[model samples]
Target: MVSFKKLTIRDILFRSRMAYYNRPSLAFVGQEPVTYADMAVIVRNVSGMLNTLGIGKGDKVALIGENSPNWGMAYLAITSMGAVVVPILPDFSGHEMESIINHSEAKVVFVSAKLYGQLDRKNIPGVIAYILINNLQPFDESVTTPTAGMPYETPKAIVNVDYCDCELPRPDEDDLAAIIYTSGTTGRPKGVMLTHKNLVSNVLSTLMIQEVNENDRLLSILPLSHTYECTIGFLIPMATGASVYYLDKPPTPAVLIPAMQAVKPTMLLSVPLVIEKIYKNKIKPELTSSSLKRKLYSFTPTRKLLHRIAAKKLHKTFGGELHFFGIGGAKLSFEAERFLNEGRFPYSIGYGMTETSPLLTGSSPKLVRFRTAGFSIPGQELKLLNPNPHTGEGEIIVRGANVMVGYYKDPELTQTMFIDGWLRTGDLGYIDSDGYVEIRGRSKNMILTASGENIYPEEIEDVINKHEFVLESLVYELRGKLVARVHLNKEALEKYYENLKHSAKDWQHNAEEHTRKVLDEIMNYVNAKVSKFSRLNHIVEQQEPFVKTPTQKIKRFLYKE
Candidate 1:
């Protein structure tokens, strides 16, 4: 076994092959699994192909695709050979994708078939070649043979090391490994420059807290372009020789339930939205249907017993072998968190951003505290800066090996984000005496009251979201007054109306009045619980669900006044 202390990703790949050569490594659920030996061959051939195309150390290669075995292979091949891998989120629009490709100055691009149409060749004229991720076929003027119009010859796989003639340059610990562009909720996207050391160090540090082994199986659902998934979901599992399964389609309940049963995954990586929806739509209805059931759920002892029963069913639905159900990307809803705690689910919360190689703090399932995102990972120091006197909340700053080198090509912007070598996270949080980190909200999103009080909208929104008729809520300050934009649960509201026969007469008018009344009721309910400054002055009905990032975080800037 090789020591992770000094090994880069390339070294780890070789070690994995030497030890678990024939073990199942990566696969799409229901698809044939790729062994470590085969994966090595693919990576080697891809590297050889890139070499033949005149790409080498420090060259940028953009990989845009949904999660697949090939996507993972392409990432390993690009980074292992001292080149930078630029992963574009597949959800990005055509213009956004082109902007990233041009901005990153990627010499070569590997795109999936589904996203191939998004690339405007004229926009990204700098790219020398474009290869389809589904199959390593190149499309470029340079790819044609000297005979003028003949397709480029695809590189053949070389199995025997003695017969191969490809030079693989070793990446230094500080070498730029990836340039991940932030899908910023506001402003233009900036590429986050992360080194090989940043990623490898974070991987090891995460494994120290959350133990994973060769026998562990991971079912990945989050976008691989997101650092949270790229690091822990893909890299950690690869480092530990764990088998990772990707969904063949979107991870909706219809597809996910069957796949879960098949994979029986030991570890599952997800954002809070997925589980929260399940709790709201599936579990909540069942719990609140009858007076007796509602009463049973209100009392502590009986509620916990009900939650335990529900949790067992949920566990069985998630393949029954789940040891770690890790959640991150956004704050988990209060109602869902309570159920998870009472039910004794193995789920835990993590907090980090793309700039930190995404794992700053995480809790183990056994040691998890409700609502907190666990302690800082080993080798990282998380501290609150400029704490408020009344409330200890302050901007979270972190310093560690896991931190990125800087934002790519934006030294001025990068300089502003750091103070004395510690990266300012911009997220407001507090660390308890026991070392758990509880995030309040983004510092930028905090509302400053007229009386000089700082109000976190997330806290208010959490309360509003707990209402039966509300699906999601956003709190923003409008002209120094707190206001809420809420997207109501249409299904729940319709069900309510259907139960009243008189409501069917002039339903449209009646529903409008009913909605207004409910919104007013919700506002009063929230205002009564919160402090005077934190109370919402108005609640505006949002006709549509707020647009969200890939992780399902509402794009706050999009809805900003």
Candidate 2:
């Protein structure tokens, strides 16, 4: 258990010191497992370096990278020193990254080697340096003559610095911690300003629910720029003295599974898409085999026994300490919930936005429910605003210490996002008698049926995702009819027979045939379960995955009905 410390600079420094003193043996897995004491030393050094560079209280410092121990260390060093940290998303383009750096008024940027060239020095104003994270190939010298000392050529462009070892600085808890930019359903990305108190409060509150410990190991693969990853991945682990691991490459199953096996993480945190894909591609097909096999597996006695065996095998694959599997970022499918429930898996679901330090509500170990995003978290006050008379559902409004100060330099947008004192979540949901919040869908994503009935695209997409051959699917309306564009699994199709040539051209032909077979079975299966209004009108094949967020949630705004 973490020793409760006063929420101050001294307290965080105390925590960092405790990590060095007590949990020095703990390992953070990246290219290798690094000790807590070593990490603290690095943080201290980096802080000193920042202080030497004249970066102190309230100054914005930018970092762009995928998830890694270095990213977390950099953020901690910056925030601990009272400087505002601006984490640029790995997916951001050169223009987008530049805009954020300029808008946030970041004096210096620590960027990954892969993205160093994305910086068009001309666009970034008032920036003193662009520090290469790993090692950028020393800029091309052929374009212009090289600088006097630096490897890069000196033009009118901005100066680039090479990041090296540094000492750490300490910041007070009242300081502005970070400015996280979130691209909403519409309009430009808005930077949500969060203070150290706002972040540390949410981290502690989340830890109260997640119940992590020094013995626990967290595997972090989500974009560090996102608030969800920032709070849960970095802060939660640091406070609990738990070690963190991150994938070196993108989190595709090829890279992720190997990393998971190597790390054997005690907790796996992810959005719904990751597990949804596993269930759709891996589990659902086994359920749809032969009628006899399906019936045998569905029997209560047999199914429960099978789940027990599967869970045991899964635990072994996860290094025998896998206690918690957290799914958030989007609503989970009911079918997937049923499978996990039957397996008695130790899984939890949560719901939040970047504005609330991203943890408004979460499930407890003893009180987890599959359908709801769980009860309101500690320190958070939740209320419904303007319920629909017919539906009894309304927007989820939140007020808490974890809530952000406001959108950076965008008071108009910030004002619109909040109502009175509560942060308007824009999610349509209702709190049940049990105090659990059940979400229906985003208010902006709701579609109207021809009969004026409201339909949630997520609802239909959930059903379509249960298909065996489908990797992903997006539900939308086209020409006044509900349509689903399904992305078929190319590898799975070819592997279906072990020697089949299920090429792209064959996808259109095979997709129709496969879709017909799968859809017929699914339609017949789900017909009795859903209302007449919830049925899909058509299903189309999509060649590519839908554009999604870092969490793998489909960008609804990019797709039209």
Candidate 3:
């Protein structure tokens, strides 16, 4: 019932309050929920405190914290008053956090108690005050006089004891709203400048494709600091009057299973890794455990029927009411996507980056195509640049209301980010005649062969990763030859060896030999599927899982030749 005419975050909140004041708005899992009415009060109170601290329109404020009710409240409070919010990823190292805070020239910082120690006073000299996110209290920086060997009290109360009476500023649609530093896989972080219109426009566009009702409940597992979750998981749901629950801890199996049952979420948004892990570690083994079972799974009719049954169980495991299970952040494994499709799971794929307020193309469950990122979103103009005639592959560029303004304080970087007014997404992909966008890979990650053929490593890695014993794989060029560094499924490998113990005379030697054979088999399997130029010359076993960004994408630069 919220008014769709609202163009800014502040106005959206105001209209949502008018429509659904008594409706549940936000909650931390296992904690009491906050109604829209209650949230309005907290946001207003914190806004007043910020005003008293001299924060106002155009001033930059930094927020670093895990996803929580308070984190959302702090974001709303700052942006509502027309101030710029710089959300730092909590997983960033102390130095990285300090660098961003200083670079943004944030006047005030709202930090979680757990990460308070990461802030260095000397590093962020521009910050005037630090506020604790948990209780919305100010950290005392003034020296306290000792009395009777006990230090005098430092003022902690920042929120007004009485209801906030200060009037909040209304931000223009074009006014700066946030500065989100990108956690890119390579290169220094760049702060993407987003306006009030950029975010609100994306939210409205997303709503056009996906529906969220007051009755719908959302289970938020991604970090709120991430643009994907911030725009879709938090703001879009808020605009629709849907309640969102944040996990108190990481969304591991132990924590997520119980939370799903308790929340009974109707919408679930996540990166591909979450579902891929579940499919590979749990479901795949069950389906391929025995020769008979594997044989049963190979037949199309029988396989589809079996998958449908398994999908029902998967649906129940994810709270049973999930109308939409959105997968984004990265391409989902083919094996997992096949399972979801065969089982008829209500899942869809999305594609975008933080620079686009995080959504440019997404398919609803009914409109999804196999391996495609869906059609271009409404209100966005998407085109392929410098196309290859034969393959139709090119860099995907977009121009729309959701597009970011520019990189903060970096004119040269901003200039290179756009071409002819269209934002260069740096992603290589092609749109089919049917209008489905199929991403090839990051332009920077693409390898050029000696024959001048463009090879997408992601395509090759996908095939490598489908092997049962391979947990994940990174494909790169070494000495002009295609090489894949694969992380084996240690647990699955151990279990396989244990099963072989009874059959082999020397299990250790046989295990090593078997590992080599399987590795060769995996290479053969991948090479058979890919083009000649994409064939792997070697497959090395990675001892550890690759380091990943906040959204679970591997840092490919670290493994680059």
Tens-digit lDDT string for candidate 2 (1-561):
454455543355457656645553223343545556666666666666677677868899999876666677677777877789999888888899999999999987877666766778788877775554442222332453323233211111122233333333455566788899866555468898998888888887887776887787877877879988878877777777777876666778787767778778888788887666666666656654567867877688886666666656656666667788888898887767766776777788899888888898888646787688998998879988998888888888999889999999988978898888888888989888889999888877788887989888777777766655667778777887766777777666656634455566675667668657655655555445567887767765677777787667777667675
lDDT by residue (tens digit), candidate 3, 1-561: 335565789987887788888999988777778888778877888888899899989999999988888899899989999999999999998999999999999999998777777777788889999887777767775652112222111123244565366666778999999999977888579999999999999998888888898999999999899999999999998898899998878888999999999999999999999999988988888887899999999999988888898889989999899999999999898889999998999999999999999898998999999889888988899999999999999999999999999999999999999999999999999999888999999999999988899998998888888888899999998888889999888787778767876444565657667778778888999989999888999988888999998788999889886
How does each model score on lDDT?
0.87, 0.72, 0.87
How close is every model to the real structure, measured as TM-score?
A: 0.95, 0.86, 0.94
Off by over 4 Å in 2: 1-10, 19-32, 135-172, 184-187, 286-291, 449-452, 478-480, 490-529
RMSD from true fold, candidate 1: 3.5
- Give Cα distance to truth, residue 11, candidate 3, Å: 1.0
Error of 3 at 247 (Å): 0.8
438-468 per-residue lDDT for model 1 (tens digits): 9999989988877888898999999999988
lDDT of residue 301 for candidate 2: 87
What is the Cα-based lDDT of residue 483 in candidate 1? 90
Candidate 2's C-alpha lDDT? 0.72
